[model samples]
Every structure is written in structure tokens, then in C-alpha cells.
Target: MTARSWPQTAPDSKDWVRDAIEASGDLVYDWDLTADRIEWVGLASGFFGTGDELVPDSGRMLASHIHPEDLPQRLKALTEHFNQHAPYDCEYRLRLQSGEECWVHDRGAVKLGEGGDPERLIGTLRMINARKQHEARLERLASFDDLTGHFNKLRLRDSIDLCLKESYEANVTSAFLVIGVDNLSKVNNAFGYQAGDQVLIAIGQHLDHILRSSDTVGRIGADRFGVLLPRCSDIQMNRAAERILQAVREMSIPVDPARVHVTVSIGGLVFPNPEHMTAEDIVTRAETALRQAKRDGRDRFTLYQASQQQNLLHRRSQTIVTEVERAIAENRLCFAFQPVVDAVTHQPVSYECLIRLKSASGELVPAAAFVPVVEQLGLVRQMDRHVLELAAAELAIHPTVELAVNLSGLTAADPTWFRALKLLLQDRPEMARRLIFEITETTALQDVEETARFIQQLKDLGCRLSLDDFGAGYTSFRHLQALNFDIVKIDGSFIRNLRDNPEHQLFVRNLLGMADAFGLKTVAECVETGEDAGFLANEGVHYLQGYYFGRPSLERPWLAGSQPVATLPALKSGAKKAGAA
Candidate 1:
């Protein structure tokens, strides 16, 4: 009876073992050292989980699981071991479960015949997928801020360095604007956490309202917004800071209206070119100025100053603020006309009405010099309203010459603006043909599909549309393709030295060619010199404007001696003067 009891094994015991592992839905394998055979089964095999099958001849089977990165050396060692009739050991990656990837650890040895021939190799495979995935998730969480979806403080340090390098390579300067909510603590204390959150989100919305889309704004600290402005100047940064402060002031953020109202203080540092100062220095200056704003009285803006900057830092800022108010009050904001020549005509097809401010000192400042502050304070729409009235009056005077005026994103969509426009156009039906309203590519893009409707409405009203500063911010050639714009103003940056810079000159040529294809007209702005003007004229710029053509001024009136439907001066007469002075 004992002799009759013998265990029955399959003819190919190896295949049977593999099939069993597969049936169990586990990765399986087998190795026969004496036969130099290595067999693996199933799509998801791991070393430690199925080590038993790989026993007796595990070396070759385990080697298949080794990561390709480590497989070379591991395989060589295993092969050497086999040649010497020693132990078998190896590890590598194996594809698994519908192409999912998994890292594994495999280890084992080979059993040999008494004649020194390898018979079988066996091992175990362990799955490391969960641990690896956990590590990756932690890395992502470490890099991102949970609230604003901005980069976290830890990531900011790393990102700023890269930003600096990129800015330098692009020959662009970087500026930092540090914003702190002045009334945040008050809100959190008087109201509640929810109110504070509402206020923060509102600030973010308004900040986005004022900044260029390319700029980066991050919530690196509680109740703080840190913005990085690339390819910017001190003038640009300070103006943006002012706008940020102004936006916070105007936002009617629904937060326990009875509780403390939220406001923000802004301070900015423009990194000096040539030196490309350390990041710490930039932060230090900006923080110092922010502290000064808090000390001076919250809800204001300031520019960072060095030791040589003096008390005049605060004084100079106050003076500028006072000057802006005065300009707005005295109707010192004026318009200058720049001719937009038809690329084919090479003659004045129309005149663009530009705004400028005259300092109390009699020096004239460009709109870029102050419009940023106006826009930030929620005053730009008012300013735009005033300008439109003035433009209409000018159109009446220059009935035949076309007059193009700009509108801000918020102003163009104001429901009442159309009515106001109609009133301004009441007497001059001829002005319709002579009137073209221009908006920045950015404003045009704010609500692309919606904006198109507004633009078409303007056209329906018989007003022409010119998309200004086509490549200034977010507007691209694609916008030209998608939306209807009669006129496209090439960014002044490319036209500033069209004669000397081959790349820029080529840019103008390419842009003109593209505009021709789109049936859109081209205009050259900031044409400062004869060479630049001549080059652009040759490059097919229909019209040119800059110091060479004329500088902006309120006294200049509208182009072609147009009648003033109304003027900034008239608007100022109605508004109260600033209380600051």
C-alpha cells in the first residue's frame, strides 16, 4: 500500500506551475538552469509574490524583473554567477495589468546538478507601486498652494530663480509687487473666517482685473498676493502697484458689509538691470515700502527706495498721487492725434486720438504714465467716458477725417456707454464714417466670443473697430483670424528700432504681409526717428506716430481741427477735486 502511494505531477511541471500562478491572477514564472530555459506567465508578475514557482532555477526569472536602468550590471553579475555555478540573483521592472507600470524587487538563487550543471532558478517579487505613488503625490502637494492654486512658499523659492534666469535670457527686467490686505485681520476678527475668504477671493479677482495675463500672481503667505511682472520697468511696476491698490478700494466684495471693509497696500521693487540684484534685496525693498504704507496709513501704494532715495520716497509718491488728481481735476488730460496711414495708401487714412497728462510743472506725460492708476482706481471707465465725449466733439470738427479713440475693457461694455455715445453723436451724422473705436487686444480677448458681439454691435451702430496693440499682451495673430478687426496696431516695441534691428524689421515685414492676408490694415506706433519712420513706411506701415510725428497733448485737440462734443476739461468741472491736497 505504501509503494502504491506516489504523487502525480504534470509532464511539463513548469508549465503547470505557471498556469496555476496565472489562474490565481498573479504574475508567474519558471526557470530551468539545466535546460537554459526561462519562462514567465501572466501580465502582472512580481518577485516576492510568486517566488515559489521560480525556485530551483530563479536567476533568469528574477533578472527579467530588474529595472532597465539597473538591469545591465545586474544581468552581468547574474551571468557571471551562472558561469561559475554560483547563486542566482537579479531585479528589474516588468510591465503589468493593461500596460500599467510597476517597480519590483526580485531575489533568488539557482540549484545545480551534482555534475555542476544548473538545474533550476527561483525567486520572489515584491510590488513597490503604492509607495512610489505616495511619494509622487507628496511632491505635488509640496509644490502647490491649496487656496489660490498658486505655487506654495517652498516652490516660490525655486520658481523665482528660474524666472530670473528666463527674464535675463529674454533681456527683460523683472519686477515684484508685494500686496498685503490691510483690513484682513480686522475682517477676520469683526466678521468671520468665511468673510475673510470672500474678501481674499475678491482681491484676487480685482488683481487679475489689473494685471497683464503674462504676469504671475501667487498667494505665498496668508492674506498676501505676490505678483511677478516680467519685461517691465520701474514706471510700469509702480503704476501696476497703484492699480492693484485702487482695485481693492473699488471692489464691492460681499463681506459682512457691516463688518470692516477690506483694503490692500501695495509696494513694488523693480529689479535693476545690468546687475540683476539678488532676490533677497528685491523682497527687502518691497517689504520695506509696504511697511511704510501701513505706517503712513493703510490702503495706499508706494515704490521701494534705497538709502539714497530719502524721505522723498514717500514725498515723491504723494506728489505723484496729488499730481494725478490735479490732472484729473483741472482737465489737464489732453489728446494728441497720430495719423494711421493705410499700408497701401502710405497716406493718412485716419488719426488715432491719444490722451496725455500735463504735469503742474508743464511737462507732458503719456497716458501710459497715468492710465494704469486710473484703471486701478476704477476711474478709467469714467476717464474713458470723458474721452469719448471729447472724441465725439472732435469728430464734429474734423467731420471728414476719421478719428479713432480707445476704450478700456470695462468701459466698452458699460450698458449706458452706447447711450452716451449716441448723445455725443447727436449733431454729427458724418462723424459715423469718420469714427473708429479702438480697444487693446487684451480687452478684445477678455471675452472673446462675448467681445465679438460687442464689437459687432459697435459696427451695427456704424462705428468701425480697430484692435489696438495687437501683440501687446494676449492678442495674437490667431485673434486676428478669429475676430473681426479693421485695423491692427503693431506693438511699438517692434517698431521702435525697425531700421537697426533686423529681427524687428523682419517682424514688421512679416506682420504687414500677414495683415494683408487677413485684409486688416496696419499702423506703426512709437515711431521716434526718421530712420524708424522711413523703415516702417517702407515695411508697409500705412501710418506712423511717435515723437517724430507728434507728442501727446491736451491742447492739441482732436485730429483735423475736429469740434469738441465735450472735453476732459468739461468733465472735470463737474467732479470734485481730490481732498489729498
Candidate 2:
């Protein structure tokens, strides 16, 4: 009985559907291919910001409202869908009746006639202004630096790459310059970081203002900016550098309480033929020149010109870099162990693991030969990792042998190196206890707090830490107190001829006194003669490491029959013998 009395169906369901679409701010249209007419439903006026009387009723009229720059893309999408039965999807901008522009997303499918030719296009159009704005912001962030609103390092490099390609094809020359703010740290310390940021922003704007329209400026470092000039000659580059220096010199940025007066140093390089050079190479050469400018004194310019000898040195450095990289890849990176002998016993206490690269010709390359190059090329991190791995392997094989490994200045602040160390010793914590990590005093003094934290991290991991090259840098008593080092290796310069050099003798004596006061063990390095070794042992040095003790050998000294002959022959009459206190 209830079914018989069912309510009548709605008069038309299409009206409700249209109303729903209108409420959602989407408009549907049926575009006739033959008549070139359009039948629109839903809120067309609201979507296009046009009054009801001005709503487009034809395909041509609708296209006229689209932004001229975006019309071609919409036309291309339409042609593809009409001819190939492809789905039509386009996002474009529309110039509304109010003279304001808005983004819109149009999606549709082509309907076919009896012969399968395009008959009509059934589509939906929705406003996408917000989404387009978000996409635009993301694009800007990816290509520009937030601090200075200029091209970021990545984008600047990409632009340089494009310019290089074009220049090579067209036979044009360009110049690149690196500009560094002199003593920005002093500004930060005196005027505060906000003032520093203001100074940086002002400097960036000044660079942009003073440079040519074709030139590009980018903030590459906290106190450094890079400029690229197209179609520039050596003379033009020099002029540009001088102009930049003058502009910065004239700038007196007001930092609230104080008007900060600052100067800049400029280094520039001209690329007459950049066929074999890369953006990285260009930047590095420019930075090298900048360093020279700073060294020459702040507020100056230095143009990098490679001399014949300099070119040869550069080629050699390149060859060494390539060799080191290949050696690492081919597993030819190894360690040579030199014993750090007991001061009294002259017996092996721990072997210092020195990094060595085996060349393709079977010649072992010393660290001094390639390390500086590696450090300069930003590849020392990789070398340091290889050294760590080799040291770890040795420790694993000889559980009883204590090994000391050196850390580069860069590695002292590298969190990644510490991570790798943790990964290697995570499962074998005992290995850390026997590990001695040697960080040079110069490296430790670079960022004393950071180095102190690194030292504490190693100590926490049960690794013994040593301050290598002690007395080589300006290490104050305060620094010695801050850094918790287990041993201090006196710089070899002071110990090389300790018995004869009275000044060095007094210096080593003071260093020894400082070590004694701190309750730290001491290792005297560069003890090449019996007198030096005897003097060091007499002065209460805890260890001796040098040619007189044992030269670094590729053979594992801890293994049976591989132990190095560490002899301290003919002690002085007043000096103690090996093993005698």
C-alpha cells in the first residue's frame, strides 16, 4: 500500500546538478565544432568576473577573454584533442571584464560524430588562481635566494652554464668576479646580526645598481657575492671591479645606533675561451683571486692571470686530484703506519695511521703531495672518510693494536664524518677505545667551540683525542683548558733540532710545562736524531714519533714479523736510556 503512494520524481534533475556546479565555482560548456558556438551552464559570470549580459556564448568570444600569452597553449591543446581524440587539459590565465587576470584550469574530452571526427567538446572550467599563485611562489623560491631576492647559487650556476654554451657557439668572452666583504664579523660583533643583514642587503642592491643590465649578481656566501658579465673583455672586467669597489666604498649603511663603514675585496677572472672550463672552475678561480685581493689588503681588486709556472702547477694539481679520485674509486687508498713509541721503552705503543694513495703505476703518494690539493678542491672530506675506513679495518683485524688517525681541518667541523665514525664503530664500540683521533691545533683553533664540541663527541665515544701540531698555532692557555685532549704532539719545528736550538728548547720546555700542568700526555714529533730523542725522553715526553723511532711503512707494524725497527741509538751521557725514567 505504501509503494502505491510513492512520491512523484523531481521535475528535472539537471537543474539541481547545474546549481551544484555553480555553487562549487565551476562552469561546464558544450563547444560545437561545426557551429563554433558554446553552450555554458553554471556560474559563468561569477567565474569570469563578467556580468551575465557579457558572458561568452561563442567559442571565439570565450577565446578572446583568455590572456594573449596563454591563448596559443589552449589552442594547441584543443587541436590535439580534436584531431587525435586526445584528452584536452590546459591551465591558462584569463583577462576578466574587470581588467584583472586570474588563472583557470580547463579539462575536457572530445565527442566524436558518426564519422569519428570531432563533433563537440564537453568541458569543465574552474578558477585556479590560488593554486597558480602557490606554484609561482614555489618556482621563485627554487630559483631565487630569499635573503637578497637574487638568483641563488644553483640558478646562477645554471645561468652561467647556458651563457658558456652560447658563448662557445658564438665565440664571445665573459668575466666572473667574486666580491667579499672585509671583516663582516667585526660588524656583526659590534652592530649586531641585524645590522650585518642590512649591510648585506644594501651591498647587494648597490652591486645590482652599479653593474650593467646584462650582468648578474648573486649572493654566494655570508659575506661574498658573485657577478657574471657577458661579452666582457679583460679591460672591461677591470673597470667593472673598480666600479664595484668604488660603489661599496662610498656606501655608509646606517645600522641604527652606528653608521657602519665597510670595504670590499674583489677578485675577477676573464674567460676568453671557456670550452674546457665549468661553472665550478670559474667560481674557484674567481675565489682564488679574491683571496689574493684580501691578502693584498682589503678594499682592493685582484685579477687572476695564470703564468706558465702557475699553469703547470694547476695541471699537476688537476692530475693529482684525478688520481686521488680514481684511487678512491678503485680501492687503492690505504694507510701507512708509523709507530708512536713509548718515551722510555722505545717499544710500539700505538701506530699513527697516515693516509697514502697508491697510484696506478704502483707508486705510493704521500698525503702532503695530494692533501692540500684535495682540500682546495673540496674533496678532502672523501679522503678523510677513506682514511677512517682504512683505520677501522686495521683496528678490526688487530684488536689489540691501538691506532691514531688524523682529521683534516674541514673534518673537525663535519657532522657527516662523525656520523660515519658512529656507523663504523656502532657495533664494535671497543674499537673506539683504542682509537686515537689527532686534530691539528690550527684546525682546533679555527672554531674553538666547534672543535671543543667535536673533541667532547669523540671522548664520549670512548676515543682518545690528541691536539696535533701543538705550539704551531696561537693556542692560549684558555684554549688548552677548553679542549679536553689526552695527548699534545709538540710541533716538529720546535723539536726538529731541540738539543741545539735554545729558543726551540725553551719553547718546548714551556709546552712541556703546560702539558704537565694540564695532566696531558705528550708526544714529541720530528725527533730525527739521537740527541733530539734523548732530549725529549729526558724532558719527560710520554711518546716519540719520527724517523729516528720508525718511518711510516705500508706494512702492518702490529702483525708478527711486520714490526718496524724503532731504535734510539747512543743516548747522551746525562739523558735517560729507553725504558729508564
Candidate 3:
């Protein structure tokens, strides 16, 4: 037919097709291969909102209304159907003449001539913008966390698995960090779940800003999040975790006029050879380290130790408890004295009595290895009592020497522990003046009223109390004001690398100033170098204790006048570097 002409003799099927297109709200189009013209029929104005005007008849004029980005694809589809007799089935964006845009599902078929060359191409365009939007919503709901808009657990797992597979093939390391919100329950209980949700959202936004673009973060649990750092080493992972911790520490969730601050316990696992590890293995390792961080006291990061197997760890724990029990039963539980000296003068002012378990082989076991296990096994009460009795006996033998003994949180809370100490001092009441009981800052803060009462009872008996690990936990001036502590031991963490760490130096200075304001003596622990000692001495710290003064010894060096300092032993992994230059 010529342009603007319709054959009056057209078949009834044409009317049927037009009726069907209009019923389905579709736009019908036909292109004549020979004339290179396109005709639109059936509610064409409805598709483009261009009134009852004659539609564009030429291919060029029709393509002008199609979206610029979709024009090439639409043309290519038509060409394929016309020249190669291929079906046209594509969905693309359409732009109407009035600046409106919508999605369309375009499908076409070719009609061939007697020579088998394409003569015409016909297609139907159905607006599917609603369906496309629905699909997009479904995709987001499937792939993202509803609360944080981060990846859901399923999507995060897929990303981690992909990274692991690539790293396995390349023999590169990958790391997963699991972050857990501490005190979330308290927030939820005190404020509301809504406030708790706000906290999670804030944490997610903060993490998104802190992580690298390549890293993947997801909400893996209600109070936990997982991050995938592809090809990352342990040190790099730790640095990232440090940033996260610092950010979280600085964040505060505002509930009207009140603000709540929270901290995170981060556990990280590094798979140097990822080939042997699965996604589950990575998460499990990270979770285990996370629990350890929480157990060791929160606001810290712990790395998974692949060298320790589950069964091996269990056995080691069992053996430690058994060893502690045997030492207590056989009366082989002893104390090793490490001198705490005057910071200015190297002379010993007192001794920190470190509990040591004597094995059957006559070798000494350090307290760090067994103390936690002992506390967990409910044996700390007995262990603490035995250590106190031994220290009291030593104090009786050396009437002028002072000894500081460590106390676990459990022991401090146990009524039996206090009674045992009271019984030990029955005949030697004067020994209490030479004794100092050390409780960690975290332990004492667990129950303020109980800790206060305990401190009062000890003071009433003329025994001094020292707060250990002063800056490692939640250090507050309010707690210092409420509790009566004779001395504050600055934790070794801020002191280990003090010479090179300006931050640590500043922290130590502040701690010293705070203690001075409270009129409490400040003792810096883990002083590994003479430079560290001199630094603390200049900062007016009262006492220093570490290998620099003397290693822990079975014999009290102060009891023997002018006794030589004990030789230092090989440093354990993760132990403070003692006696370093």
C-alpha cells in the first residue's frame, strides 16, 4: 500500500489482529522491507500520549521516538529478523514524544518473499514498566538486608565463596571479620528494639564508609556482621578492624536527648591457603575468636589461631584445669615474685606475686595459661585462697615486704574467698598491712556495689586494693571516685610499644595525670626497656614492673638483700616483648 493508504480489500484477520492488540493494550507495528517505512496501529497514541495524530510512517521518523540507548538494539533486532529470518525478542526502554519513559517487551517475526528474502517485519510492543519495577523490588528484597540495606546472609555467602574460590586458585590469602555489638541486649531492654535497630543501621553505615570498595559487608546475624576482605593479610585485616573499633567507639546513638555509646568485639580469620577452607570454616573460626574477645573482655579484636584445633584446645583446657587441681591438692601451687620498683630508683619497693603451678616434672606453669581455665571451671576461688595463704605465710616470714596477688572476678564475688582470707589473718592480723589484692578493672566494674563493698571489707582489714589493667577496660573517672583503690596498674597494652607510639605516650600521660588527681599511685606494667622506664619516671609514674626490673622468680629477691635480678626467659607468642631495647 502507498503511504497513508489502506487497501479496502484487507482480510478479516487484520481486523481481528487489531481488535486483539487493542484488547491487550499493545502497540502494533509493521515495516515494509522494500519501502523502508513503519506503520503503527491500535492505541498508538495511548503508548506515546501523542493525541489522535497520524503516526510516523518512515523508519527514521519512528526511531526518533524510541529511547536513544534502545534505538540501536531495536534496529539490530529488526535487521536480524529481516535479513537472517531470526526472531526478535527483546525488552527495552521507550521514550515518548512528551518526555515520558517506559519499558516495552518487543517481539517480531519476518514474512519472506518468493525468493526466500524478507519482505516485512511485524512486532508487538507491550508496556511492562510495572513488571520491571516489581522484578527490581524482588531482586533487592532477595539480595539485601531489609534493615541495613547491606547484603543479606545468602548474598554475602555467595560473595565470600566466590572470593574464596578465586583465592584458592591463585594461592592468595583471604580474611573474614565478624563484628558483634556488645551491650546490644542492654540497649534493647533499656530503650527499645527500635533504638537497637537504629544502632545496627548506624553501625552498617559506618562500616560501609570505613571498608574498602572491594570489601563486602553483610548482616550475617541479628547482632553480628561479616565482612569479606579478598586477598587480605592478617596485619591488613587487623588494621581494618582497628578502624572499625575506633569508629564504633566514637559513634553514639541518640534517642531524643539521651545518647548511648556501644563497642564491638571483632574476630578475624585469615586463610593463607584458602584451598583447604570452606565458607563455614571461615565463619566458625571468626566466631570462635569473637567469643574469645568477649571473654577476654570486649572492645578488642582476636585472630583465629589455626595451629590450635578444637579437640586439641579442649584437651589443653582440660589438662590446665587438672593441673591446677593437682597443684592445689598437692600444695605445689606457688607464687613467683616479680619486683615492682620505684620508677626513679631501680630498687624494689614491692613484689607482684604471680601464681605458678608446679608440674610433676618440676617445671613452672605461668598463670595466664591456667587462670582463665581455672576461673571457668569454678576453681579460681580455691586457687585464689591458696595463693593468699601462701602469700600470707611469706609475709609472716619477711615482716617488712609487701606482696600483691592477683584475684579473679569469680574469687572476688565468692563469699568463701573472703572468709578464707579472714581465717588466714586470724593469728597474723598484722600481715594484712603487707598484702595487696589486685582485681582487674573489668572485673571490678562488673558490679559496682559488690566491688565497692569488697574493697571496703579489705580496707577494713588493713589490706590494700589495686586496680589492675586500668586503661584496658572501661576507664571512667566516676568509677575512680566511687571505689577506693590504693594503686592503679596501667595495662601493658599502652606501654609495650610506648617509645615509638605517640598515642600510647599521650594515653599514659593522661592516665598518670588522672591517677595523680585521684591521689592514687600509678604503676606501669610490662615495662620492657630502660627507655620505657625513664619515660614513665619522667611522667611521674610511681612504680614499674616487667623483665626490665626482674623476671618472675620462685625466690623473693627483696628478702635476700642485694640479690641479682632473675635472668629473662624466651618470650612466648603474643606475650609482651620483655627486655627489649
Clashes of 3: 0
lDDT of 3: 0.80
Give Cα-based local distance difference scores for all models: 0.65, 0.82, 0.80
Alpha-carbon error at 130 in model 2, in Å? Answer: 35
In terms of lDDT, the best-performing candidate is: 2
Q: RMSD, model 1, all Cα superposed?
A: 25.9
Q: What order do candidates take by lDDT, descending? A: 2, 3, 1
Q: Which runs of model 1 end up more than 4 angstroms from their true locations?
A: 1-326, 342-347, 359-363, 529-531, 553-581
Query: lDDT, candidate 3, residue 303?
Result: 90
Compare candidates 2 and 3 on TM-score and give the better one: 2
Write the residue-wise lDDT of candidate 2 on 117-224 in tens digits: 888889999999899887686567456666688776556766788877777877888999999999998998898877988898999999888899999998766678
Q: How many backbone clashes does candidate 2 have?
A: 1
lDDT of 1 at 548: 62
* Model 1 lDDT per residue over 1-581, tens place: 45653236647776766677666544544577656665656534243334445432344544454446877866775677778755555444664434455665556676777887667766555566676677565455455545456654435544556677777777777788789888675776677767887777777767776799888776645677778887788788878877777776777767665534568888777765554344544555677888888899978887876664644443454455567677777888667665555434446666777776777787756665566545543356567777887787776665566888888765655546766887766665677767888887766775454467567667766778887775656555666766787878777777765677898777778778878888987777766777877777676666666556544434444345755443332122122111100
lDDT of 1 at 36: 64
Error (Å) of candidate 1 at residue 256 is 41
Error in Å for residue 276 of model 3: 32
